[model samples]
Target: MNETHAIAGVPMRWVGPLRMSGNVASTETEVPLATYESPLWPSVRRGAKLSMMVENGISATLVDDRMTRSVLVKADDAHNAYLAALDVAAQLEELRAIVRKCSRFTELVALRHEITANLLFLRFEFTTGDASGHNMATLAADALLTHILQSVPGITYGSISGNYCTDKKATAINGILGRGKNVVTELLLPRDVVHRYLHTSAAAIAELNVNKNLIGTLLAGGIRSANAHYANMLLAFYLATGQDAANIVEGSQGVTVAEDRDGDLYFSCTLPNLIVGSVGNGKGLDFVEENLTRLGCRAEREPGENARRLAVIAAATVLCGELSLLAAQTNPGELMRAHVHLERKSTSTTVGGW
Candidate 1:
């Protein structure tokens, strides 16, 4: 079959010379976002502008980094399943050796398993250098599966992925155990800065966060997520940087925290599953390459440094947008007015029959 491909264009913009400092990266740089939501550019810019007003700006920390894949096997019986899990767990060094053969960058860092009714689910976690490690983790898992089936008695292959890895879906396991780069970004805005740039008081944004993000999400049965439109910023950043856009599924599963610290605003966004890489499947694209370079993610560094830098930037961007949106919601007409003005080219419209 002959196949033709076409380019789908997304409006791209550089939103900030955002000030960031952390263990991974300490640089003030403009980040690129490709999106159809024109309002996002200004909203995020507002947040970035606030970041600069603070003394330390945004402090992003890389808490953990790993990629995961799970493989399923069937045992002769429930007893056999338990035994097989024990046997595989004992072979950690051997499994690590097999992973090394798959790729120099792939290292088997940890293993976990669950057994039910003669079925075994083996979760393999890896440290993949400078890549998101989706394919790399799968390759390592495949090799380990082959070795396990041969050595461990009473077990046969079932399938490669058993959903325990929980790729591209909002699952509680991903948030609890984590997948990809885990980053926590924080900013402390003075009461005056909050009032000046956000046009909202610290107490107001903090109250809205509890009512809307925390309580509202809980009542709605959201799984391990509480935030306003984290997916929006993540999708835009992922697309601009040539990341696997679909990773935004698990990527958006993050939490936002706000506090009125004696009249100052203490805001944070914790992204436990930010799956991004500076070099990967989409990195070959000219635009993606350029964006990564401009974001300072393509520089030669230690084995996982580039990806870590990208993850922190992505988290900071999330915090910026999250902060801005929460602040806007503190006012009755601000959000709708801005949307109408930016998206519809008009600012005069009744909001909720006002």
Candidate 2:
């Protein structure tokens, strides 16, 4: 068995895919590539660097800093609903200020509502600082709920979680209205690179995307996303980085678009629900912190900026894995053969035609 250790000048331990010279291993190859290069290529291991960063641009509209929650309240009647809505609106400024007072790292960004017969679903969005902001949003909501229960007349508390905030589960609301980090990563791979590295042509990859991801997903009634194994890459990255792994349900809700631009292959992954944070929760772990630091996501420049960087890098990594897998699927039995060779520990050699 080969010894696995940390790469020099980097934080990640050698899980697989070391660049070898002669019979001896020297340096560790990075992820995704390692997914193909290592003997454990079928098992997979995977990140952000300048080549990825070049394709990413952080949304300037305070996008990464925002978190949203929906609270349901029962009113006596429609008139009471309208009155309660008015009261909520009237206290918007006060609530914004109250969020700051209630939570040290949260800021109220916006509050909107929907009124039904006697139900009021008030949605609140916030800037949650270097955290993923689910708890921060809930904390702010609790504070706001307390204030509303005290101030609004003829209203009763319904639920702190009304599904309007749309946590964990996949929903159209997250795709349309946006949730967590909205990242779109694109790459224009050269025809030579496409054929040599990916082992497929641009046109073939684009056609496979249309038929497999788009039409196939529609036939299967997929919810809000049409892609190949996005959750696979997201889950791996989330585990390595200490993110809330459950968020992958919504985090994988995205669109994968492929096009043959001239002779080059144009591939992109637009993910709207990527909830990642550089600080808080599991980041305190020694390995997690080391990974974050190596990714250059532990920036001290601003509060939520490091999380934004992490999100983009994640999106880029998703793009790489997605591209590679789709290309592999173009050839018959290539994917399974890799799995048999790397994943299976059996002595039998005929599996998957290997």
Candidate 3:
């Protein structure tokens, strides 16, 4: 472990006994239908391995002892968290454009509403680097959005009620999930739910479980996209880091789903409310300061619209990472081959240009 390692475990190599476990908490308490898939894990492992090499190489350059090698690690939770963050980050530009239009209409109606909250509340997809991009995108959006609100027809009615430098609110629109983030595969138990769960806690509600006999029989089982896992993990990371967790309701989404060879589950996560800031009262919150440091996020990244950029970065992180995972499992040794191929292709393309 390096001096910068924040996660409890040192080396992220090997899950030891990678068997499917019971389940993560779900607010929907209906018939518990389980989903299945096997696309995300291998790619995530591949990325983590690459990061490990980087960290180890950096450490080895400084010290001669093999035992002294170390690097910041990406665990299973962190893996999912980072991927979801990336997906959310990529949607920043689209969200910005949409919010600008939405605010004009919502505010012009003269109703006692603020686009501030709604504008900041968003959904997008991207991938994360080795670490969770929760703080990264939140800070990115917080910085980027102020300009959007300021440039518009006076964003007098959005959720960003507070301000840092710009007139935008100190509280950003909350967010969840990233692109290509991986998670367990499973079907929602209820099988049919049209009502939008405004609150993030709705997933844990028993009525959504669908596993209660008659309803349970109607429940469907299959695989989900890693996006769902990324969405939930990002939410969990946000909650742990003192972010506005409620945004998960508005900004969260599960992007893709499909069945595995075993026909179990497939799912993905999508979220919009990536409300976060680089500097805030929460900086003093327990362990949040430390967590930020672990993720390598810094204050410079927090500014007008900076949050949006970081959000995009988070999504990109997940995208690249999930691709990495998918490549590894479907073809064993493919990960190594890809790295080599990418290098060779880059070289060939560069020489061809000359």
Best by TM-score: 1
Residue 288 lDDT (model 2): 81
lDDT, model 3: 0.29
> By summed lDDT, which 10 consecutive residues of candidate 1 come out lowest?
345-354
Q: What is candidate 1's local distance difference test score?
A: 0.91
Give the poorly placed runs of model 2, Cα more than 4 Å off: 1-65, 345-354
Go through the candidates in order and give the clash count of each: 0, 0, 111
Using TM-score, rank the candidates from best to worst: 1, 2, 3
Query: Per-residue lDDT for 23 in model 2?
Result: 15
Clashes of 3: 111
Q: Which number leads on lDDT?
A: 1
The better candidate by lDDT, 2 or 3, is: 2
Worst 10 residues of 2 by lDDT: 18-27
Across residues 222-311, which tens digit of lDDT does each residue of candidate 2 receive?
A: 888999978877777787788888999999998999999887887778898889888889888787887788666785656877787677
lDDT of 2: 0.72
Off by over 4 Å in 3: 1-226, 254-272, 313-354
Give the TM-score of each candidate: 0.97, 0.81, 0.29
* RMSD of each candidate relative to the true structure: 2.8, 8.2, 21.6
Q: What digit string (tens of lDDT, one per residue) describes model 3 on residues 211-296? A: 32124323533222123234433344444344555444433432323223222122122323334433444456546665545443
**What's the true lDDT of residue 235 in model 1?**
99
